[model samples]
Target chain A: MKTLVYVAHDNVHLGDATLATVTAASKLGEVHLLVAGAGCGAVAEAASRIAGIGKVHVADDAACEHQLAENIAPLIAGLMTDHDAVLFPATTTGKNIAPRVAALLDVMQISDILSVEGERTFTRPIYAGNAIATVESSDAKLVITVRGTAFDKAEAEGGAAEIAAVASTDDAGKSSFVSAELAKSERPELTSAKIIVSGGRALKDSATFENIVMPLADKLGAGVGASRAAVDAGYVPNDYQVGQTGKIVAPEVYIAIGISGAIQHLAGMKDSKTIIAINKDEDAPIFQVADIGLVADLYQAVPELTAAL
Target chain B: MKALVPVKRVIDYNVKPRVKADGSGVDLANVKMSMNPFDEIAVEEAVRLKEAGQIDEIVVVSIGPAKAQETLRAALAMGADSALLIETEEAIEPLAVAKMLKAVSGEVEPGLIILGKQAIDDDSNQTGQMLAGLMNLPQGTFASKVELEGDHVRVTREVDGGLETVRLSTPAIITTDLRLNEPRYASLPNIMKAKKKPLEIKTPADYGVDIAPRLKTLNVSEPPVRQAGVKVADVDELIARLKAMGVA
Candidate 1:
C-alpha cells in the first residue's frame, strides 16, 4: 500500500508527533512525507532522514505558512491522486485539515485511530476512551488521523530519502491569520515529555499551583499538566489541561498530585508506564490506576518530595 | 444577522458508556441523553451573541432520531428563534450530517454557523470542518473566543502549542472548544416558552443526501483495565519504588 503522511511542523522544526505518525503509517506500507509551509526546506530535509520514509514532498509557498485548512486541504487533495491512503497526526492542525481533504476527496475520514489493524481497519477510542471500536472502511480512498501517543516513535535519523518540490497552490482568500498567543514554556511539551507532573484543584489558585507544581516539574525536568477542574478553576492555562477533553499523554512517568482522577482524566494518562498518585484522600479514584499510591497531604508531601528529589 | 447552531443528543457526559455483550456497539437502551456538552457551549455562545444584539435571529439544527427534537427544544429554551430537525433513524456519519447541514444552509443563508468541536459519543471531530469544506467557507475551529467586527469575525482558537487568532469574513464556521463558555441551564419559564418555538422536521431525502455508512464497525469492546499497584507508606518509599522501577 502507498501512503502519504502529512509532516507535522510549524514551518521551522518538525513536530515529534509526526515521528509517531510516521511509525503508524509505516505499518501500512511505504511512507511518503508531505511538508507544506513557507520556506520549510529544513523541515523537509529533517523528514527525509527518518528511517523508513520513502520520499519527502515539499510545498514551499507563502499560502501555507500558517497551515490554514483552506489552502492545505486542497493541496493534500490534489496530491492524493497517486496515493491510496493519507495519514495525518491528530493535532489541532491535522483535525482541522484532514476532514476538509476527506470532503474534497468525497470520502469519510476516520479520526484519531489508535491502531492500524489492516489496510482499511483500525481501532479508535470512543465515549472518551470508555469503549474501543474497530472499524473498517469501504471507501476507495482512506483519510486518517493518527493519535501520536498510541504508536512508538520512528527513529529520527538513519535513512536518506529523495526530497521533491511540488507546485504551490493559490491562496483560498477565505481566512487570514491575525495573531498567535502561544504559551512560552521552558520545559518540554506535554505530549512529548518523558515525565509529567500534574496537579488538580487541590492546588487552590494559580499562584499556589505554580509554586507547588512548577518546582517539582523543574526539579524532575518534566512537563507540567493539570486536571480539567484545575484548568476550569483558572489555576492554569487551558493548554496545561491533561484529560479526555484536553491533551492525551503517555509518558514514562506521570505524577498526579492532589488529583482525584475523574474517568475523563484517567482516560488521558492511564497508559503511562508508571503512575504515582499523592492525594490526601485514600479513596481517590486515581489510586485505582496508579502504579504507586501515596496517601498523604500533598501540601506537606509534595514539598518534602520536591526537596528530597 | 442570523446565526445557525447545530447540536447533538448523546448519552449524558456524566454517564459511562457500556459496550454490548455482542460487541456490536455502545448500548444506548434506557440511557439518559442530553445535548452534547460542547454543543451546549455553542448554543450558549449563540444566545449570548443574540442578547448582545449582534445576531437578530438564532436557528438551531439537529440531525438525529425523532427524540432529537428534545435537544432542539433545549437549544430553543436557551434562546434560539427556531429549529430544524433532519429526522432519521439510521446512524448518520459526520460527512452525511455535513451534507444535510449544507442543504439547510442553502435555505437559511445564515451569517454564521457554529458547531461543537466533536460529539462525545462518536468522538469524531469532523462535521463542522467538512461542512465548511463542502460549502467552500472559511473556518475558525476550536475557538475559545469569538468577536464580530463589521463583516469579519475574529476568533481565538485553541491549538496544540497555544492560542491562535484568525479573521474570517461573514458566512464562516466556528467550532466551540471546552473553554468557550459555561452553558446556562434552561429555567422553567424558558422551558415553557420553548414549547411554542417553531420546529420544522425534514428527512435526508429532502436534502438529496445519502446517509450511508462509509465505515463499518467490526466490534466494540472496553479498553484493557489498568491493574492497581501497591501503596507506599511515605514519600521516601515512593521515591525508592520509582528508583527501583528505573523511572525516577
Candidate 2:
C-alpha cells in the first residue's frame, strides 16, 4: 500500500505530531510526506529526513498559510488519488483537515486509532477510553488519524528522501484565517513532556490555577496541563486541556492535582509510566490508576510539596 | 434565519461504559442515555441565538433508534422550535450521517448548521465537517465562540496551540467545543411544553441514502488496567517513593 502522511507544521518547523504520525503511517505502507504551508521549504526538507518517509511533497503557497482547513482539505483530497491510504496525526489540524478530505473522497474516517490491527483494521478508544473498539474499514481508500501517543516518533535524520514541489490548489475562498492567539511558554509541549502536572476545576480561578500549578511544574520542570473541567471553568487555556476530546498525552510521570479524574481526563494520561494523585478526595477515580495516592487538600499540600522539593 | 442543530443520543457521560463479556461491543442495555454532552452545547448555542433574536427558528435533528426521540425532546425542551428523527438501528458511519443530513439540509435550507465536534460513543468527530464538504459549505469546527454577522459567521476555534479565529460565509457548519457555552438543564415546565412540539419522523430510505457501517467492528475490549500502588502518607513519603523508583 502507498500512503501519504500530512505533516503538521507552522511554516518553519514540523510539529512533534508529524514524526509520530510517520511512525504510525509506516505500519501501513511506504510513506510519503505532504507539507502544505507558505514558504515551508525547510519544513518539507526536515520531513524528507524522517527515517521512514520515501518522498516529500511540498505545496508552498499563500493560500496554504495557517493551514485554514477550507484550502488545505481540497489540496489533500486531490492528492488522495495517488495513495491507497492517508494518515494524519490526530492533532487539532489533523482533526480539522482529515474529515473534510474524507467527505470529499466519500469515505469513512477512522479517527484516533490506537493500534493497527491489519491493513484495513484498527483499534480505537470509545466512550472516552473506557472500552476499545476494533474497526475494519472496507473503503478502497482509507482516511485515518492516528493518536501520536500510541506510536514511537520516527527519528529525525536517518533517511534522505527526494523532495518535489506540487502545484498549489485553488482556495475554497469560503473561509480565511483571521488571527491566532498561541500560548507562549518555555515549558515543554504537553504531549512530549516527560513530566506533567495537571490541575482540575478545584483550582477555582485562573490566578489560583497558575499560582498553585506553576510552582509544582517549575519544581519538576514539567509541562502544565488541565482537565477539561479546569479549561471550561476558564482556569486555563483550551490548549492545556488533557482529555478524550483534548490532547492525548503519555508522560513519564503524570501528577493530577485537585482533579476528580473523569474518565475523559484519564483517557489522555492513563498511559503514563507512573501516575500520582494529589486530590483531597480519596475516592476520586484518578486514584484508581495512580501509583501513589495522596488524600490532602491541594491548597496546603501543593505549597508544602513545592517547598519540600 | 433558521439554525439546524444535530443532536446524538449516547450513553450518558456520567455513566461508565462497560464492555460486554462476549467482546462484541459496549453494553448499552439498561444504561442511562442522554443527548451527547457536546450536542447539548450545540443545542444551547442555537437556543441562545434564538433568544437573542439573531435566529428566527431552531431545528433540532437526531439520527438513531426509537429512543432517540427522547434526545430530540430534550433539545426541544432546551428551546429548539421543532425536531426531526431519522430512524435507524444500524451503527451509522460518519459519511452516511453527513449524506443524510445533506439531504435534509436541501429541504430545510437552514442558514446555519451546528453540531457537536464528536459523539462520546464513537468519538469520530467527522460528521459536521463531512456534511460541510458534501454540501460545499464552509465549516467552523471546534468553535469556542461564534458571532453571526450580516453575511458570514466569525468563529473562535479551539486549536492545538491555542485559539484561532476564522470567518466563514453564511450557511456554514459550526461544531461546538466544550468551552462554547454551559448548557442549561430542562425544567419540568419546558419538558411538558416540548411534548406538545412537532417531531417529524423519517427513515434513511426516505432521504434515498443508505446509512450503512463502512467499518466493521472485530472486537471490543477494556484497556489495560493500571494497578494501584502504595499510598504515600505525606509529601516526604511520596518524595521517598519517587526517589526510590528513580523517577523524581
Provide the TM-score for each candidate, comma-separated.
Answer: 0.99, 0.97
Q: lDDT per residue, candidate 1, B108-127, as tens digits?
A: 99999999999999999999
lDDT of 2 by residue, A157-197 (tens): 88899999988787888998899999999999998899999
Top-scoring candidate (TM-score): 1
Least accurate stretch of 10 residues (summed lDDT) in model 1 chain B? B239-248
lDDT of 1 by residue, A1-309 (tens): 889999999888999999999998999898999999998989998999999789899999999999999999999999999898999999999999999999999899999999999999999999999999999999999999999999999999997999999987899998999999999999999999999999999999999998899999999999999999999999999999998888999999999998999999998899999899999999999999999999998989998888887
Clashing pairs in 2: none
Regions more than 4 Å wrong, model 2: none
Could you say which candidate leads in lDDT?
Answer: 1
**Model 1 bad stretches (over 4 Å):** none
lDDT of each prediction vs. the true structure? 0.94, 0.91
Residue-by-residue lDDT tens digits, candidate 2, B102-188: 998998889999999999998999999999889889999999999999889999999989999999999999999988999999999
